[model samples]
Target: MGDYTDKVKTKMEDLIENEKNQWIDLALKIHENPELSFEEHKATQWLTEPLEQAGFRVKRHLLPELPTSFFAEWTGTKAGPTIAFIAEYDALAELGHACGHNIIGTSAVSAAVSLKKALDDDLPGKLVVIGTPAEEEGGGKILLVENGWFDDIDAVMMFHPRDKTMIFRGSLACVDVDITFMGKAAHAAANPDQGISALDAMLHSFLAIKQLLPSLPASANVHGIIRKGGDATNIIPDHCEASFLMRAKTREELHSIKRRVYDAVRHSTKAIGASCTMEEGLIYAERINNRVLGYQLMYNLERIGVEVDSSEITTGIGSSDIGNVSQLVPTIHPYIKIGNAITHTPAFTEATKSPEGMAGLIQAAKALALTAFDLFQSPSLIMQAKEELRQTINQRRNRL
Candidate 1:
């Protein structure tokens, strides 16, 4: 077993060195050309082209309904334990790869490619690379999972870029909603009393939420924007729309908070004599990290000289599509730090493309590939992971 582990390590090291330039170039290309969620045509092509060229049978699952979203798979000759690597290529709106999705695409692809190269000699499992889209808004992984995309996979793994490297305990709750208020439009000056202002309803909703903040838990968050307001200045606007994102520590807590939010909106609109309509957008559950798999990743990372402090286990609150994936299967989404800059900002964008970012990319690829290798090689670890997931599912069912 030790000999086999060493062989895999040697193979990964060699593959990293050999494919360094290719991976870096891929990252830069994706970074240079950013595409928004479900609109990543060029980015998807760039990601899958290299894999297709490397003799992997590339299959695309196109939802004609969803043009920008796709699924790519590569099956190995021998199938023991199916290991999956997930890739995200969709960038933020107008920000390009500011969230460092280019690095994410590159790192996942590199891990899959490296694993493929290692398994060429004696294949023990099937390697699947799934291209998930619209992680920023639509919870693309949740959609894919609901469509039965991750049924047979034994385990799922993906790494994200952050300001530090650590195994996170869990993620926060996320809920997206769209609210619209409808009122009668009339002349603002001549018939001010005859018109009901939708803008006033929105303002009242905001104020009501602000007043409710003291009642909300520390972990809960309520933030939003008025996407649409009155069009004309002299006339009262008939319709106004707003979007909100509410987050909390648990799914139940988020639901509770959502109910209050709905009541607030309803009452606010009612106070202004306007009708209100609310539509639920996307609801992402908190991530429950598989502790056994997370520890295995930490072990593999340590073997590769990546020092992750135990104190770094508890990270900040953020939501991800991978959180949705975690509920369906045993998964790990470890964050690897490239620099001290926070994500979703210009500084993060600049740091993500810098030399330090490239180096972190390689290190992240190495860690992910090695972790996959460990899962492939150790049946005990695989059983441990499966058992952990089974217990979690059972516990949730029992509580229900």
Candidate 2:
């Protein structure tokens, strides 16, 4: 079994290598045409084009609201585990693919295509590639999970390009709060006393939250930006809006933080004789990296001659929609080292199309394909992974 697995892995790697140029071109093209979240129509079309040509059955716009999202599947001759690859293609506003999503989306496509070619008609299980959009701002995966898109998948996997290569990392559970304050508007020179300044209330809220942060836990934090401050300095502002993103180690902790911050906003607005309302986005749950699958990925990564770094991510964590998907199925969002520059920056944007970036992309594709091959060849691994996910979920529920 080990020998056959090795041969299959070799074939998969060869397939990726032989067509590395084409894959590189695709990644570069995606980098050139950067699209924002939920508006990745071109990216969706480009990503699925190769899959459809390779004989995978394609479905576009799984959800009416999420029109850019899609699903492509290939069924085997026999019944087995269904493994799905999650693809993210949304770019940041103004930064234009600075987050390396171009690398991410293309790597998933290359991996799935190579794996299918290596196995051919001998595949024993189902393979699917899910195109998930709006990850940067909107919770695209959260919507898909709620709609039952991932209900039948046995395992899910995706790769992220980072400064370091790690298999297991923790992410914060997060939610965005949009706060709006309303007050009476009046001319500053004519009757300043008659006007209630909404900007004052917004500023007070920021101060109040800053004061509250010291009392909160180290793992919890709140960052905010003023979406609408005022129209002009000569006139008293009538309306103001501030957006805050609160994050914590877990959703429970995040909830507590939100309550405190909401209280602060209310009190601050009331003190300034203004009324305020808060709107929140979907809650992004903390990540639960399936140890069973993560270890398999680590092994395969090393087999491809890429050195494995520490498997545990203890600090410097952020939130992602993948965290929501990890809650349902055995999932791994492993990171491959692209360069020293971090994500969401101009330097990182350049690295996504650089030679080093291309190397990381190919490495990521090979590792993903090989690890997926492991799941198809060894069903016990899938069972163990699912059991691990069950235990983790139960433990989280007990804590709550």
What are the per-model numbers of colliding residue pairs?
Answer: 0, 0
Q: Give the lowest summed-lDDT range of ten residues in model 2.
A: 307-316
- In candidate 1, how many Å is residue 367 off? 1.3
lDDT of 1 at 336: 81
Best by lDDT: 2
With candidate 2 superimposed using the best TM-score fit, by how many Å does residue 79's alpha carbon deviate from the native?
A: 0.7
Distance from true position, residue 224, model 1, in Å?
2.3
Q: Assess every candidate by TM-score.
A: 0.91, 0.94
Looking at model 2, the pairs that clash are none
Tell me how candidate 1 scores on lDDT. 0.82
lDDT of 2 at 340: 94
How many clashing residue pairs, candidate 2? Answer: 0
- Model 1 clash pairs? none
lDDT of 2 at 68: 98
